[model samples]
Target chain A: EDQVTQSPEALRLQEGESSSLNCSYTVSGLRGLFWYRQDPGKGPEFLFTLYSAGEEKEKERLKATLTKKESFLHITAPKPEDSATYLCAVQAPKDSNYQLIWGAGTKLIIKP
Target chain B: SAVISQKPSRDICQRGTSLTIQCQVDSQVTMMFWYRQQPGQSLTLIATANQGSEATYESGFVIDKFPISRPNLTFSTLTVSNMSPEDSSIYLCSVKVQLSTDTQYFGPGTRLTVL
Candidate 1:
């Protein structure tokens, strides 16, 4: 089974604090890694997609990096508006279809 | 990026009643997906809606209870049949901009609260 595990279930940081959220996965064949930001009672918003190891993508204050077995979402100088649950998902290879396996996600609370 | 919108942003329904959520995409998409998320939980894909064919459901989800309809490439609807308190969740619609990649854009979501 394809599985994804995110570390630090919940995080509390002050404004301008820098932190990183981790997502590790195990799958038969990895196709891609995705990052999303979700607010309370709202749907997830797409952030970035990392394909291969050593690949990185950035958006504003958020940067996503992928490795062979894991991925990281780094937030630099976060603000209260950036407080949201960060989700990481992995797309696994199938015979002819692909399904995404999601992690529980890390809840980030940025206190201003 | 695609702009997706869902109707009835939030609703309170009684048990045994069913609710149908509609998803509209600004641009035509090849693949449209439906997902459910319980409070404080990760998103679970329910099915994939194809324009001309039947919707493909995932494990633990059936068409009878969660019937889906995709009339066209830019529109779809998911109906939660025989609703219960356990069915209270946020239903989301997503679409893949590129078929080869797994990058999916999501709608604002409909928050259903069964009482």
Candidate 2:
């Protein structure tokens, strides 16, 4: 079965602190890995999509990198406004439609 | 990037009542999906709203309970039927515009509270 697991269910970081959240997965024929940011009372916002190992994408202070069996979302000098739940989803090989296996998400708190 | 919107941002309903959530997209998307997020839980996909066809439901979700409608490419609806307290959740609508292979843009979810 295809599954995604995100570690460190919750993290508390001081302002300007940098850390990396992990998303490990086990799938048969990985198609793509996605990262999303969800604020309270709001749906998830798209962050990055990593298709292959050694691939990376960055947006502002958020950086996403992909490996064969895992992905990492690295936050650089995160601000309080950057605090949100980071979600990880994996798309495995499917014959008909695109289905995503998601992680529970990492709740990040940036204390000023 | 695509813009998606959902109606009735938040609502409180009595048990046994039903609620329907609407999702509209600025542009036509190939795939639209409905998801549910229980309090403090992750998003669980309920169904895939396929245009001009029957919506495909995921396991543990029934068409009789979470019926979906995709009359066109730019709009869809999801109805939560025979609601119970356990059915209270944030219902989200998402769209994939084929910008690439992945990446689903989501709308501000509808917060449902059942009493």
Candidate 3:
């Protein structure tokens, strides 16, 4: 079965500290990989989409890179406001309904 | 990106009662989806709400247990029937805008608490 797994279920960092979250997926005919940021009691906000290996996207202090087996979301000098659960999802071309296999998400906390 | 909204931002219901969550999008989206998130867990796809057609439910989800209706391109409703404590979860709706077909934007979500 196709699956997506994220590493470091929870992480804590002081303000300005940098870190990276990992999302490893095992699926055939990978179509796209997406990143999202979600705050408490709210729905997820779209961040970036990576379609091919070596592709990278950036927004503010966050950058996402994709590879064949995994994707990494790197946070550079994160602030407390950047604290939230980062989610990863992948889409397979075979599924006609455009279903997304989601990861468990990594809860990152940046404390000042 | 599309702006999506859900009615009943949060609600507390009794066991055995049912609740219907509504999802609305600002644009005429091509696809709408429903998802569930249990406490401390990841999101699970419930079904795909196709306009003017029966919803396509995911594995382990049944139409009778969680019925979905899409009356138009921009509106949909998901009803949780015969609710139980196990049904207590955050129900979310997402849309894939026609302009951005590859990405999905989510609504604020409906938080349901069953007791």
TM-scores of chain A in all candidate models = 0.97, 0.96, 0.96
Task: Please state the error at residue A103 of candidate 3 in Å.
Answer: 0.4
- Put down candidate 2 lDDT per residue, A19-50, tens digits, no spaces: 99999999988889999999999999999999
Please give the clash total of every predicted structure, in order. 0, 0, 0
Q: Which stretches of candidate 3 lie over 4 Å from their true place?
A: A94-97
RMSD of each: 1.0, 1.1, 1.2
| Candidate 1 global TM-score | 0.97
**On residues B1-115, what C-alpha lDDT tens digit does candidate 1 reach at each position?**
8999999899999999999999999999989999999988999999999899999999999999999999998999999999999999999999987776679999999999999
* Model 2 regions lying over 4 Å from their true place: none
How far off is residue B82 in model 1, in Å?
1.0
Tens-digit per-residue lDDT, B1-115, candidate 3: 8889999999999988889999999888768999999998899999988787889898999999999989899999999999999999999999988645589899999999999
* Candidate that would win on lDDT: 1
lDDT tens readout by residue for model 2, B23-88 = 999999988999999988899999888798899888899999998989999999999999999998
List of clashing residue pairs for candidate 1:
none
Q: Find the number of clashing residue pairs for candidate 2.
A: 0
TM-scores for all predictions: 0.97, 0.97, 0.97
Give stretches of model 1 more than 4 Å off. none
